[model samples]
Target: MRVGRELTIGTLSRRSGVNIETIRYYERIGLLPAPPRSQGGHRLYSGEHLERLVFIRRGRELGFTLDEIRDLLGLMVGKHTCGEVQTMALAHLDDIRAKIADLRRMERMLAATIARCQGGGRSECPILDALAGG
Candidate 1:
């Protein structure tokens, strides 16, 4: 892509692999600075917009919330310390670990309950019994 090439929202969505509605939502939420428009009022996204969208998409893929991504983007715009970014990353890492632990616990319980289940013939389902107990 050219350095200054202007792209339509459709083209940007295709190029960045982000949905058009997502792009509009990002703009509305101020995650993305609104782009310039054509005389017809079509949003004309530039390379910068594409780059930012890709960045936002990657952040989302990595499980960052929009607010977290906003904080990271905040770092990109002004003078900042690597320490600040690292701190956020560390906190997010902790959150991921906790979620993984919870998921593992859930998996084990569900697997055990399913194992106890005799399957099709019996009306007494271990899964339902466990759910009822809770």
Candidate 2:
């Protein structure tokens, strides 16, 4: 929340908990606005840029795709209602649930296959055999 006339990219990265390369990548990808440069061609970020980077980093941490983040940003700027946001969130939730279910299924299958292994030597390995189309 440090309001200032100018801040270096490093300072902004430290304040926002985002790396400098990521900030530049976001700018290049249009996720963040390109900041003005100093007389020596160094990037000068403002407090607004800092907050926007923080927002983007948080969105990434929350597992949102860049495209989804872009849509959310649009909603933030446009006439977005709670319903729209809720719908998007619910869709993401469904995707997460599906992935969790798939992972649970895989875990169960792996556990069953491993349980068939007795750790004895010279015996056919059930895990390897199962993996080898048995």
Candidate 3:
């Protein structure tokens, strides 16, 4: 979509790939600002709002939490340095790496448990036994 057009909520949703409900939720949560209303009480979002929504969607797609996005947005609105942004990003990267490590550990444990299962139908399943803490 072109960047200069004023948009309704629906149009902003389509343009930013965020749903209307999510847009309202973001507004409520202060991630997004409440847009002006038309004379008919319809929301009138600006291109700037559309851009901010797009930034939020992209941040979510990248797995940043809303708080992190809020901080980033705060930094962006201030006269902050790239060093500040990099510090936040590096901390987030460490969190992602830790989560990946934990998932890998879980994968190994699950695979080992499943591998120990001998496939006889009668009753004695190792998977179920393991899950039951036996």
State which candidate has the highest TM-score: 1
User: Candidate 1 has what TM-score?
Assistant: 0.95
Top-down lDDT ranking: 1, 3, 2
Worst 10-residue lDDT window, candidate 2: 1-10
* lDDT per residue as tens, model 1, 1-134: 34477999999999999999999999999999999999999999999999999999999999999999999999988799999999999999999999999999999999999999889888888899999994
**Each prediction's TM-score versus the true structure:** 0.95, 0.88, 0.94
Q: What are the per-model C-alpha RMSD values against the true structure?
A: 1.3, 1.8, 1.4
Q: After superposition, how far is residue 94 of candidate 1 from its true place, in Å?
A: 0.6
TM-score for candidate 2, please give it. Answer: 0.88
lDDT of 3: 0.92
Question: How displaced is residue 27 in candidate 2, in Å?
Answer: 1.3
Q: Which should have the higher TM-score, number 1 or number 2? A: 1
lDDT tens digits, residues 1-134, model 2? Answer: 75767989999989999988988899999999999998899999999998888888998897889999999999988998989999998998898899999999999999999998998785789999989989
Instruction: Evaluate residue 87 in candidate 3 and report its C-alpha lDDT on the 0 to 100 scale.
Output: 100
lDDT for model 2: 0.91
Q: Look at candidate 2 and give me any clashing residue pairs.
A: none
Runs in model 3 deviating more than 4 A are none
Ranking by TM-score: 1, 3, 2
